[model samples]
Every structure is written in structure tokens, then in C-alpha cells.
Target: MAWQLHYTSARRGPTGRAGFQFVAETPGLPDGVRAGVTPYLSYRPPPDAPPSPDDSELGLFPVSLLYDRVDGRPLLLRCSYLGRDYSGRYGNFFAHAVVAEPDELEGVRPAELWHAPHWTHRPEPETPVLESLDELVPGAALDPEALAAWLSASGPGDPYALLGRLVDAVAGVLGRGHGRVVLVADDVELVARWIAVVSYSLPVAAAARLSFVTYTADPDGAAQRLVGTTPAIWASAQHHASHASAFDLRKGVRDGDASRFARTVAGCWRGPDLAGLDALGELAPLNDPAQEAAAALLALCRGDATVTAAEEGAAAELLSRRGPGIPEWVWRDLVPGVPSMGLDLALALHERARAAGAAEVARQCSLRVTEGVSDALAGASALAEIAAAAGVAGRAGVPVDPAEVSAAAARCARRGGGDLGAALAGCPGGSRDALLDGVVAGLAGARERERAAVLTPGNCDLLYAHAGRLRAVPVIACAVLASVGRRRPGHRIPVTGELLRLDGETGGEVDAALGEVWSEPPSAGECADLLDAHGDAMARRPALAELPSRTFTRLAFPGGDGLTEPAALRLAERVREVMPGGRAGRDAALVRAYGKAITAGPAGAARALADLADADGATPQLAGEAFVGAARRLCPRPPAFRAELLAALSPSARARLGARWTAELPGRARAGRAPLRGAEVGQRNELVEVVLRLRERGVTEPALEAWARAAATRWLAAKQLDVHLARSPRLRASLRDLLGDGPPSRGGR
Candidate 1:
């Protein structure tokens, strides 16, 4: 890797100025037959083509960066210096050279590669000077002749700001028709220049198309290996304008900074134009993390003089996750315990994850967290997705609160009001981008299309809606949503209906989506119907069985329409066919179930009550208004049901009546036609029981009267009867035998 150099004099600005050159066939010029060319400059150049803005005694050198592929071997090293004049004139300082075997190749002359048809230059003022980019704007009146004179007279000033300014200008000037732009950052550090360029010139090129190539390990060794393998590279010298001391590849980056870098590139506007790096053709993201760190640091300083420790940590964490190239400084900041500045770094990680197509878990977690933020508590979701995406999950300590980030984003969404997209775009660094497109579509009523494309039909996807996933997010159905895996004891997995609108047009491709699955939970009977529909089919296809189980237990359809009513009826039948006890058959669970079912309507309630009475499983409590209606319906008489309604009144009702049961009854003799419900036997009146049973059996009123009289007289003859009817119509008719012979008066009792 020895080198031979030749010094060339400036043609215009100054004399005796030295710029070096290396021929491809110099015998020791780092291996070559006609080794294309190398522009890893370590020395200053002519005024017309300076190497860097900070080129003091000597600017930064090229590191021999190259694209492994190219079309021809003209191997051009074109250089130009664009400038403006004090007299308000503009022109370029241009120079070029083609490194070749010489005296052989045709159509290969660097001097002929001018951007425009012709070129021109002007004289300089005696003493030249360098100015800031700020001074360059308004009316860019700095020319190359004056710059060259300035370089020779003042001898190189700090190029940091200068080079940055050039990036803005170059992109605009030479940016047209180029979907892609390449910066031949041969100095390795020049990659920093690329990032700066991306920030300023993003208005010109798409981020996807903006990538660069770099040397791995040894630049010289790598170049040597490519001698016979890949085609020779043709490249230009990088015009890096930074004070040499400003760059140190050993430092690390912060997540905050990385995020800022990304944002700058994504947004652009307001500036000048100048071009040159096109000689670079195309380049990739810097292979070095330092570039990112450097760019981020620069951005940080630009925004604020100081950065927080948390900001550094976040950037470092994001960088470390991306690759092993992060220096120790980036992974952990020198100073710890700094509070977070914002979610920029974390958001950048998400953006990068999305960009690399490596963060489904991260995306989900992010969405889940956001959902949680919207819901005050972020409900039951887990952070597995975030961990997977950021590569810090399960690790000892990585302050990742997907929910917090999401909550902030939700607030941001609300703040924007009418235009969520604008809000998203305006958010500096947040997961809004990850969920933006989906949320926007969701709010626009496109969920159905998205659902069909992403899900399977007839299948609910509550696969992750429980105590640990898909918690209660406020904007769930608002289009933006995320979910997590959930678990419960002895339970079946459920299909959670998605909240956002589907993005795809056809469910044909949806794995197993179902639109109807998201509807409200069915009434008990409806659930039973659903269960029955899947019945044995569930055994063969367990999924069907699972669906019923979810409906019966796990799935909490919104409250209404008499939940589990049908199940109650079904269970009652089951009890009669199974249990033999009396009220024991009307256990607590049965009571609740049947009671709920009775609320459905009068007819259904009457049938259920009749069935219960036959099975001796009826409770004293009438379930609701419907049950009362059912009782009054059949009798037509004021005292409707003949099922001993008063006898079956729940204990609570009896306790509430206290002595009123007797007092109220004795006084109501005139209004003896009791409520449609049957009578109560106050003192173990067997006659009343017989008459009620007979009435229940459809006995006519006369038959009921005969039955009651016969039973009552026999009881009265055998024992001193102490009884009264609680809810019987014409109590005197029922109490005749015991009251007669005395001709009981309807007078004062």
C-alpha cells in the first residue's frame, strides 16, 4: 500500500500552491494495472477544488470509499467550487482528471465534464475571506476567486458550518430528475457529511433510495481485494468542511439524536442550490454508527446547547439495537440520571423498526401502549411486542413504557382535532407514524376493508383481549389500535373484534376474520342457539366448541336483552331431568338464571313458571313485571295465577310483610278477589293447598269450591282450625265451613 504523489500548481487563484495526485499505474499506488482511481485525499487542494470547508493546513483525506459496481472505467475525479461575487455575479471554479493507463482510452477526459455548456472565473480582492452560511444567504455574493484568495491569504477556516450550507445548496442546484443522490464519503468521517446532506437535501431525494457504500475493516486491503473481483470504482473527492477536531468515530449515539436525524431528513424546505456529489452517483447509509451519532449530536446542538443523559441513553439504546457498531459511550451515557427530554429516541426506534421491517411486536406493543394511554390505565396488554422490536424486553432495565408513549400520541391526536395526519406529521418523535396510516384509515370508515383483508370471516379475534392484552384503549374503535396476548384459568381463547377499519379490500386473504363476531353478545337463548348450532360439530372441530365456551363465559357482550335467559330455561329443564329435590332444585344459581329468563316476556315467563311449579322448583319471588303479567294473564280474575303465588313469595318479601300479612289480609275481606296470583295458607291450611293444586290442574271455580269445602270441613271436624287465606278471591267462600253456623258478619273485624 505504498504511494507516489505528484504536486500540481493552481491555475488561477494562487501560484506555488501544492495539490497532490496518485497515478493508478504508479507501480506502488496501492495495487493496480490501471486501478481505476482513488480520491482518499490527505492534503489541501487547489482553490478551485478544495477538499473540505475546514481545510486549514490540510483538509480531511479520502478513505477510498467506493461502490462495488459501475458501468464504464472513465474513473472521473471531477471537482468544482461554486461561488458568488461582491458585484453580484455567480460562477463555478471547476477542475477534473481521469486516472488511466494514458495514451489509449478514448472518450475519457475529466476536463470535459462541465455541468453547463461553458465555464468562467473572476479575479479576487487582494485579501480573501471565508464567511458563515448565514452570511451566504440573502444574496449569496461569495465567489470562488475570492474564496481561493481567502484560502491562500487566511489559510483555511472552520468548514463545519460551511459544508452544511453546501449540502443545502448542492441538493437544490443539482437535485432535479434524480430520485437518488450519492455522497462519496471517502474519508469515512464524510459519512457525517452525508447525514447532514440528508437533513438539508431530503427535499430532493426519497429516503429509500438514499443509501451509500463504504469500506469494511481495511480501506487499502479492501481496495486491493477488489482489484480482480469487482469492477474498478470511479469516484470524486469529498468536500468535507469540518474542523478536523470535531469528528471522532469512537463516540456513540443517543436514541433522541437518531430520531431527530430521521425527522430532519423526512421534512425539508427553505434554502439555496449548488451541485457536485453526483460524481458520487449513489451511496448507502453510513456503515458506521458514528455518522449517526455525529449527525444527531450536531442536531442536538442546533436545537439546544445541552442534551440530557436520558436523551443520550435513548439514542445509544436504539443504535445498539440496530447494530453492534455502537461505541460504549452511546450504549450508556457518561453522566446518568438525566430526566427524559421527550420520546424522540424511543419513537426513532419505532420508526427504524418499521423501516427495517423488523418490529411487529414493537408496533403492536406501541399500539397497545397508546391504547392504554387513551384508556387511562392501558388495561390488560403486555409488552412482548415492544421488547421484541427494541431488543430490550426481559432485560434487566430498559425504561420502555409503550403505553405512555401511546397516551401522549393520543393526546396529540385529540389536539389536532380535524386533521390527525397533520398532528402526526407535526409530532417531533413519536409512534404516531407507526399507527398513523392505520388510524387515519380507521377514522375514515375504512375498517371493514381492512378487516376483510387482514382477518378470516365468521371468526372473532379476541385472541388477545383479557387481563394481559388489548386492554381498554379509548380510541380502540377510533381506527388506531393495538392488542396483546391474554390468559385466564379454564378459559378458551377468544376472537377480539378489531377496532380499526381494515385496510385491505377483500377478506379473501384474511386468515380467519369474521365481521359478525364483533356484534354484541347474544341473549342466553341466542347464545344457546349458537352453542347448539356448533354442538357436536365443536367436538370434531374444537374451535366451534371454544366459541360456545367463550360465549358462555369469557365473552362479555354488552349488557342487555336478558343475558343467559335461554340458558336459564335450558338449565331448568336439565334440573327436572336430573335433580329430584324441592326448592333445592331452585338453588341460588338456578334462581338467578330463571329469574333473568322470566324478564324476557309474559308468555315465556308463564311457561317457565309453570314448568318450575310442576318440578317443585319454583321460588316464591316473582322475577319481574313480566312474571306478574304472566300470573294475571291466565286467571282473567283479579287473582290470576293459581300456583299459590303468595305461598311462593321469597323470604325477603315475607319478612317485609311482618304482621301486615295477617292484618292487611283480614282488612281486605271486602276486596277479597286477590291479585291474579293464587292464595297463601296462613296457618298450615291443607284445604287451601288442595284447592290451589286443583286450580293449577285446571279445575273449574265450582269444583275448586267443592274441593275446598269438603277438605276444609273434614279438617275442621278433626282439628281446631286456625287459618285464613292470604291472597284468595272471596275469602269467605274459601273459609265458609269454619266461619258458618256463626253466620260471620262482614261488620267490623
Candidate 2:
């Protein structure tokens, strides 16, 4: 697409008005005509006008440049109707042409097109550099001078892409009404070219509203020069600056210095400002896992960094890695969902984790910290929150400094005093128990005066109370004892049944601040006995549960005289121990079920019996005892219900206790009272009848036989026994002493 222009001839009319001629080589001209006027330009010299530079009677004309769409290069033409006369009807009107140097072109100013009257009176302004952008950029208007300057400095690469991004950014900044943007690039020349394109792309008036500055070396001078009233400023830099509002342009370019690069960007006043963070993510070295992980730290620093779903995934991946470059703020921000901690400790943890290559510990610690931090935040005490975070770290299998925990706990105690229970309650799950221990240790180490203030009788009671509800935490119980010793030097905590006792000032060397008191751990029997004597008192009063060394203690023990379903269940785990072996053990199981039956309901007793019978280490005899106890307690039940209960037990247990259970059934049915005449007599007969039916089904034993014979004798004398018993040969044989001489002799009645 070679583009050129030349003067072919000039003609003068008889009236002394000259007409010029020129030939153009513009390929693909409309209708295939290559010669015509371009730039829609025209000129008319005065009658006394001087000859042109070629001395052929032609003068200079100012015209805007045009770019070929195929390649971004400038083209010039001289004609009256270059594009308008594409049909060649006016081809003979072409004017002679002359090309001039840039300075020479600038020297001669042209009147504004179609506004010659205004320009004719006023001084003609310098030739406004313009370009026909319709062919190259559609509707865009290009500043020829600015485009020339930018193209010259843009070096090697696609500068147009950068131009598009800069234009969008400037448009956004303008819409925002105020903004501070810094464009980061490789060198000063590239930065300058980008700024030039962005500044001139907008309408001339709108472009004047924004200020542009490019800082290379001297920041102080640049800062001074930045003083202006412009609502928006777009700055560019080749290097990092701490105060810069930075946006990196090094997208998709892994430089291997990502860690250092990211750190510099992160240190900026507004962090990375979201402009090129995605690009920086690509800049991270893919070959080095450590460097990639390190690069992520800067992104994590921004609160709003997770701008996209991909970013969220990236954050998760980075967090899963073992990066040694973790900063202190990350740790501080992790706990309590807020940032407030010194760098030394967090830095130490980072170093330690880095050395051990245990990034998983950090990951787990962060998760656990978040899980428990909400409760601490609700507790409204920063110290308690810190302690809770430490506890969570411990739960996550991350080692935390004892001093840190102690200090946080001590501060919490000092601030909260008697409200320690409330504070502990605010912590969730394991963190609650963990924070409790720390509070005890921390308070114990305090001066006697300070300890006394926090461990006042009421406060100790409160702390002890909190300890009780906890599933397992011994230090809190010890702290209570310690506080008690301080108040009453030799007093022991009074536990029912004497299961646990702590003497003040024991001879054994111990932490005196913990009341210098100690007690031997109780045997399982003692703990069980204590729970039995207490009934639901432990459930009602948490301190009772906490007072015992075993944090797992609950109110229910099996052999209690008045057992409850809850008690039976609380001791369910230790059922075998409660009813060890032998007949005595069986009797104890019966007693437990009996107590539960009396207090609660038959259903509850049955459940308890089943649990006891099925417990590990339970003997067959004990199981039998439990079955009999549950069935006997359900006496006077319907026949079907009694059968169902018996069937629920193992075959051996049913066989062992069925007889004893049947023997008790008759008495239980009558409610242990003799039947009277009339309906009472009928009811008595029915009870014996049911027993007979049970015996017929092979459910009776020797005990049932003995009971049946005795019951028949008593019923006979009172006329409550059914005389028809003589009909059944089996009953007649068993009750012969009461049924009389014969089986009624059929017709003797």
C-alpha cells in the first residue's frame, strides 16, 4: 500500500485565475479513481499572492495528516475533492502539491475549516495538529502531536494494548471524581508513552481535568510539583515507593523475584489497590513452591483481596502451603477476628513453624482460632480472647507459650474478678476448658494480695463453679482448693460420703499459691459411692461435680438407694464395676433397677436393666437379676406385655430369672394384700389362673411351685381359690392339701 502524491500540471484561465493539477497513487480508491482531493481541504490565494516554493505559482496550505488502516503510518494528499470525487467526474481539478518539514508546516497556520469569517478577523492560531482517525479507530479523534510522541517512545512491543488499559483507568478515575493512581512499568520511556496516550484519548476539555505526573528519581521534587487543584492525579513510576498508590503492569511475567516484588507492593500506602494483583499473582514463580507461597502473603494482607472465585481458590491453596514468609499481622488478625498483638511472639511462632516445616500446624491453628475467637469476642475481654486463642492453638496441636497464656489469663482474672465463670462460658468447646486452666495458673502466680482480691470466697466459688460444669479440667479444682487454704488454712472441702478430701498445707511440696493443699486421687468405688449419695445434687450444683478430681463425674451411680434414670445413665459407662460379680452383685443390680422403677417409671427401669445386663464384663447371673428386677417391677402387666419383656432378654438370663420373677408375680398382682369376697375373690382366682397359665407354658420354677402351693392353701380357707382347680389334674396334684380329698367326683356337686 504505497501512498504518494505528485504535481502533474497547472493551468491559468483567460481571467488570470489559476487551476492546479496533481496525481495521487492511493490504492483501492472509490470507483477505482486514484486522483482526487484529500483531507477535504481547499485553498484560494489573494490576487497578489506570491509563488510557491517550486516557483510555479502555487502557495502553502495547512492540512491534517491521515493514517493508512493497514499500517499505522501517516499519509498526505493535495486535491479539491480527493474522497468526495471518487467517481472521477472532477479529476481535472487536482492541485499541485508540496511536502514540507514539521517546523516549516507549523510556521504556516490555516484558517479554521468552514469558519473562515471568524478566523479571517482574529489572529490565525497555530496549525492545530489533527489526524483522521475514522479509518483507523472508527469514531475516535486523534491528536497527531501526542500520537507521534507516544509512538516514538513506546519501544518494542504492542503499545496499543497498554493504551486501551490506560484509557479505561483514566475514564474510571474521572467517573470517581477523585482518585490517586500510580502506573508501574519497566522503564521511564514506557511510562511516559502510556501517560501521553491516556491523557490525550479523552475530549480536549475533559482531559484537562486530570493531572499526570511521572516520577523517575527525585520524589521530593515530584511531590512538590504534585501540588494542584485537579480532582484526579495519575502518576507513573519505574520503581517502588513506600508512599505510592501502586498498580503493577508486570502481568503474566514471572520474574523469580515475586516475593521481593510483592513485599514492595504490599508496603505501599494503599497496599496493591486491586489494579494488578491478579497479574502479580501470575508473576509469582511457578517452579518454586516457597516463592509462590511467600508471594501470597501480600495478597492476604488486603482485607478485600478475594475479589473473585478464582482468587478465593488461590487464597486457599496459598494458605495450605508452608511459607516461611508469614508476617506477624497474619497471626494477630487470625485470633479474635481482629488484629491486636505484638510481632515478637507471632514472629517467633512463624520462625519455629518455618524451621520445622509444619505449615499444617499454622493452617489448623488459624481454623481453630477462628472457630473459638467468636466466643471470646462475645465475652468482650481482649485478654480472655487471647487466652481462648491460645487454648484453640493447643487444641489444634500447636504449642503456645505458657507465659502468653498465663499473662492473658491473669489479666482476664484481674479485670473480670468474680465474673470468671461468665467469661469461661463465652468460650466454646475445648477452648472453654483450656482457658479455665490458664486462668487458674495465672492467678496462682500472682502476688498474695492480688490473688486474694481475685480469689475472694465468692470469686473462688464462681471459679470452682465453672470448673464443675467442665467435662475435664483438674487445675481449676486445684485452684479452688488453693484459694480455700488461703482463707482457712487447714480446712478440707466437705464432700458427701467422704469420697474426696483436701487437707490444707499438706506435707508434700506443692505450688503454695495453689493453697499448698493436696489429696490422693480417689478409687473408683469412692467416686461411685459419692455420686450415689449425692443424687441429682451434682447436676443441680455444678461445684459438687467440679470439687471431685475427676472432671467426668456426674450425679448418677447405679447402687444409690434412690436411683434415677439419669443416675443410671451417668454411671452406665462403669456399670460392670458397680455390679462386679457373684449373687451379691446381681442383688445390687436388682436394687438399682428397683430404685429407678420406683422413682421414675417402668420404661425407665427396663432401659436401665437392659443397659446393666448388656454392659461389658457383666455376669450372666447379674443379667438375670436385672431381667427379674425389671419384670417384677412391671407386675400386674397384661399377659402379652409380660411375655414381651421376657422375650427381650437373652435366653440364658430369661431362664435363670423367669422362676423368681413368676413367684413374685402373684404377690405383685394382689398388691401384697389378701383378696376379700365378691369381686376381690374373682380377682384372686384370676391371679392364680394367670400363674397356672404361665406354669403350663414351662415358665415356672421351684420358687413358683412353692409360692403356688402356699397361695392355694391361703385362698382355700378364705374361699377365694377357684374350686374348679380340681378339674385340672396338674393343679389338683399341687394343691391337694387345700383342694380336699378328691377331684369333686364329677357329679358330686
Candidate 3:
């Protein structure tokens, strides 16, 4: 009752032949024993050469042990072939062959079997079960130096890192309590490294429980399905177990069927056909959550079918569980469809992404949440969540939307009275002005009553507290003052020094508002009227001295007469310190008024004039001219007053005025005023200097001939002129030619 078996090798071509040679008659040594020699396949035949029997049977192929009907003995048909080695090169190949039944193989099981070409003398080595590294390396030591070296050279596609991932996938699959696992990979290096990693990295129990298989290409044929179930020898990696069935992606299996399962492929392989599984929508479980999630997300991303809510939830859960290790492509595929997948899934992924320190992924998730939210409160809440996440991410060296953070804070402040200062504090430099503008706009929308409540005299610190930047604080403070003034017309809105010194748009707005409310009086009315209206308020805000140039000019020199009004002088002085210089075409009228005020002889008038002259340096000529004109117009009745005022000026000031007065002499002479006549000694000296200057400029001979005619009639009658000629040798020298020997005395006249 022994089974008879035989093996044969053949080739087909013009020079080739096919024949079944009787290699052995087998009453096999044991079920695992075989008879025959492995074929030589190291030298690959040319593509046009006839196919050989050794090349035909390269991988795990199906076969059976059949019982003979008459003899009651088993029978087998044996064929043999060559397969690629683990390294993928067709050299030094291990042989695979099947011995058939010649009177049936004795002592061998009369059941279905999977066979490959092999030599009877070269039995395949058993895969070593590895429970710990100690089984492979001494003391279970991890070589840190080797590891560091590898990592230094390793990148995203590093073989070792890929191997690590595959190992993790294997452990994950085995942890689910599957008794059998099949790994399929197209790459020789991946397959080889996977084998090594399994033995060296995985526990013995896990490694021993798994099975692996390889495939052979049939150029002109499809794989034949075996009738009965049996353990298949998958290359040298499969375990000799009766329950381990050969994997076929086209085969159907029930969910409860533990007898057969090909759960995952190690490399790129398609999932099992959906129609092949008893569960209608269930795909073959992937080896790891990351892969499973990526596949599921990809389905949604591709729009291949309408994904239900349940499927999206399942994918989100998978992502959360395996987020840190998931490849970047998965996120790239998943994020685009996140909005339609529901906010809950996005939220779940957001947390997972942030935890994994994938900042951009987290930001994308948060943005998707923002896009998905439809309700106002919910939108605001989503923005708040984004802002909070941004802060945390910022500290972690990750970026989120700072603008969104600012917007969220502003919204929250509007809703719950929160401080916007905190929201604005950490904004980047480029964003500060934009955030400040938002704050200002938000404050401007407040109710009149609300503004009055917070914009009180004592709440200046509140302005700084919420205004974010120092320059911006004044803007907001000034705005609040203007708004409160408009609402409560008589409200004593105290503006801060910051507001007074404000620049930019805020400064202009505040100044315009001040002019509108405490307006400059018309010139017909005295400056006393303006003082009566705004003096109390001006007194209350001493910081008014620091008002912006335009606002200071408006309040200090209202009606162009306030500078000279004794009643308005204190208020004028208070704001005068901050007056803008004349560069931008301001300060001319103010200078004139100020000069007139000085002539009025109010206390500190001289100091005021000096301050004005310094402050309006750009208009020094105008100021000097104004002072000289004012002295002439206002000090005429008391001629000595002019001398006193001129002496009180700085030497530079006096020089400027003297030059200006001398310039005016030609105009005065054209107006028929006596250019050489003056009431005060200083005035007389200035006129005498003008005449001496004309003489120096070569006008002496003509001027003396012209003046000699008028000198006899007008100049001799002028007593001050007579006295100057009596003492001043220079004055007498010029008139000596005109008077012809110091004549024309008072008696002669």
C-alpha cells in the first residue's frame, strides 16, 4: 500500500525536448521527506529559449495525494521548477520539486499538499522562533553605536526604518490573537530584511505563529484552485501545520472561519476582493492602524464611493490611535476632505496631530473646523479653540493663526468683556498694527453709555491695559474721549498725555474732534470767549501741554488773538510747549500773535517770545519780522517801551529784529514815513545805522544831495536827529557834506 511517485524535467524548443524521466520510486522516509535533485537555475536561460520544467514550478504550487481506485494506494504527479532567491538575483538558487505517486508515496498523508522543487538531501531550515534579542545577540544588548550610526544615515526611505515599521505591523497583527499571518512583498530586500527583523526583533511566540508566502508568475495562465484544504509549503517560510491553508485573494471565507485568513501584505498589494468575504463591507484587516486609516481615508479622498458617517468615524479613530507613526501622505490625503467628514473627526485628528507634534496638520485640522462650523456662537467658539491651540502650538515651536487668535479675542471681548490686551500681547511684529486697528474698531462700536462708564477721568490706566502698544494706547484713549464728549456734551473727559502726543490717524481724528467741540473763536470776538468756554477743561488736563501740533495750535491760539489775551495767556502757555514747528507751513500766524502778545507786556511775555522763536525755528524770519512790526505798532505811544523790549531780547534775537527793521526801511520810505526819524534812542540809532549803511553801499553822495534839500527843511527840525549828529562822528561825517560844515543849527532854522 505504498504510493508510487516520480519526478521529471523537460524543455521545449527546436533544439529542446520534453520527457518525464523516472527520478524515484518513493516509499518516502517520512511525510516531510522527499526524493530528487534540485535543478541548476543560477544561469538564467534566454527569453526565447524553450521553458523548462525547472522554470515552470518556481513558487508554492498546488498539488494533491490521490488514492488509487483499484489498488487502494495513493498516487502523485511530480513536477519541478526554479525560483528566485531571497536576494532577488537568479544565482545560487535553492531548488523546489514535487515527487509524484508511483504506487503512491508510502507513509505520507493521502491529503492535499503544496509542494515546491527541492533536493531530498537539502531540507529547508526551520525559521528560528525569536522571543527576545538575547536569542539572536548576546545579552540582548542593543548596540547604541550601531543604532546611532544607522539613524545618522537614515532618511524617510531608510531600509531599517521601513523594516521597523513592518515589524511593528507584524506585532500589531499578531497581538490581535490571529493564529496565522501571511506576508507578501514584491521587493527582495524588503522581504529579506523582514525575515531578519521578525527573527531578531519579535518575540519567539509571535514569530512562530506567523506564516509567509511568495508568488510565481504564470505568463499565459491563471492560478488553479485546489479542491481540498491542506497546509501549503510557502517557499521555506511556511510552517508545517495542517490548518494553515494556501492564500488565494479570490477565495471566499466566512467571518467565523479561523481555518483560513490572509490578513495583510507586507508591501504594495491590493485588498481582498470585497465579493470574496462573507461580510459585505468588511475589508481584510490591515496590519497596522496607520495603514488601515490611510486606506479608509483614501477611499473618502478618492470619492470612489459614498462614504457613510460610520466609516469616517472608524477612520478617525484609527488615525487617533496611530497618529504619531502614520506617514505624511495619509494626512495629505485625509485633510482635504476633513470638512465634509464632520467636525468631530477633525477635532479628533487635531488633537492627535498636535500630540504627534505635526503642527501643520493640526493647523489644517483647526482650519477645517472653522470652515465646518455654521453657527455664530459655534463659529466664535471654534475660533477660540483655534486661538488656544495657536498659543500652545506657538510655545511648542509650531505655528497657528495669530490673526485668528486676535480675532477670537476681539470677539470674546465683545461678548464677555474679556481683555483684548492679552490677546494682542504676543502677536508678531508685522501683525501688531493690524491687531491694534481691530481693537480700535471694536472699541469704537461701544455704546455711548458704555464708553462713558470706562472712559472716565481715573481710568487712564485702563486705556494702556487694553490698547496693546504704547502709541496705540493714546489713539484709543483719544477716541474714547471724543466719543464721550459727543455723548455727554459737558462731560469732563480727561485726555491722557499719550492721547495728547498721539500720531498717525488717531492723532488727526482727536485733533479734528477737539477743534469741532472746543472750537477756535471767530476773530471778531475776543480770545476771552474761547477761554471762557474751554479754560476749565484745559486747566484740568495739564498734559494738554503735550498735545499734538495741530491740536495744540488750535487750543492755544484760537481766533489768532488768544495769544495776546491776558485772560487766555495761562491756557496758551500750558499748550504752547508742544506746539509744532513751522516746517509744514504752520506757526506763521501763531508767531505773529505771539509777538503781539509779547508787546502787550504780559508777565513771562519775553520768555514766551523766546520759546516761540526756538519752537518755530523754521519760521525764524517771519517771527523776527512779526516781533519788529508788533513793537512798532503797540509800543509807539511809550517810545521807551521799544528800547526796553529790544534790550530784553537775546543778542541773536536783537540782531534778527534789527536786520528785519532795517529791511522794512525802504518800504517805510516808499510809504512817505521819515526813514531817519525815531522817538527812542535805540530807534534813532537803528535809523542812523540804516543811513550809514546806505552810505557804505555807495548811496551816500546821492542820498546826501537829496537829503541836503530835505535836511534843511525836515532834518534840522528833528531834534533827535540833531542830537545824534552832534555826538556821532559817523552821523556827522555823512551830514557834513550835506550841511556844509556842521551848520543848520536850531537858531538858524
Candidate 1 structure quality by residue, lDDT tens digits, 1-749? 11222212223233423232221112333244223333332112232333334324223322222222112322323233333222323322222223333222222112112221111122222322212111101111223222233323321242323333334333332324222223322343334333333333332223212222222222222321111011112121113322111112122122222233333332221111112121011111323233334434333423443455454454445454554433323213311211222233434433444444545534543443343233321321322222232232212123335444444333332333233323333433334333333333332333454433332211112213222222233223211222221222112113222322233332221212222332333334544444444333223232232333233232212221222345645634443344324442443233444453335343444345444333333343323322333332332222332234333433333222212222233322213322212333332243344344534544424533443343344433223223344444444443554235643333221
In candidate 1, how many Å is residue 230 off? 38
User: TM-score of every model?
Assistant: 0.25, 0.27, 0.28
Which sections of candidate 2 miss by over 4 Å?
A: 1-405, 412-723, 727-749
Model 1 reaches what TM-score against the true structure?
0.25
Clashing pairs in 2: 36-82, 37-79, 37-81, 37-82, 482-514, 482-515, 556-567
Ranking by TM-score: 3, 2, 1
* Root-mean-square deviation of Cα positions for candidate 1 versus the true structure, in angstroms: 24.0
Give candidate 3 misplaced runs (Cα > 4 Å). Answer: 1-165, 169-289, 292-539, 545-656, 659-734, 737-749
Clashes of each: 58, 7, 24
C-alpha-based local distance difference test score of model 2: 0.39
C-alpha lDDT score of every prediction, in listed order: 0.31, 0.39, 0.39
Residues 1-749 of candidate 3 have per-residue lDDT tens digits of: 22232333323212244332333333332353232222211122223223432444443332121111222212222222333333433322222233333333322222212221122322132311111111111121122233334434533344333433444445454555443333333332223223333333322322233433222222111121121221221333344433233332223222331111222221111222222221211222323334344445546545434555566666667666655655455566566666565555676667776776778877887766555432222355422343334443433343444465456534543443333344345444444454444445444565555444434433334344443353544545665555444444334323323344566556466565554333322321222333344434433332322222333244343223333544334434433432323231244344445655455673345554555555543344434444554434433323234334445566565455444444444443323244333443444444444444444444433332343334333443445456655766766565455446554554423
Give the candidates in order of lDDT, highest first. 3, 2, 1
Residue 341, candidate 2: C-alpha displacement in angstroms: 15
Q: Please report the candidate that would top TM-score against the real structure.
A: 3
| Model 3 lDDT on a 0 to 1 scale | 0.39
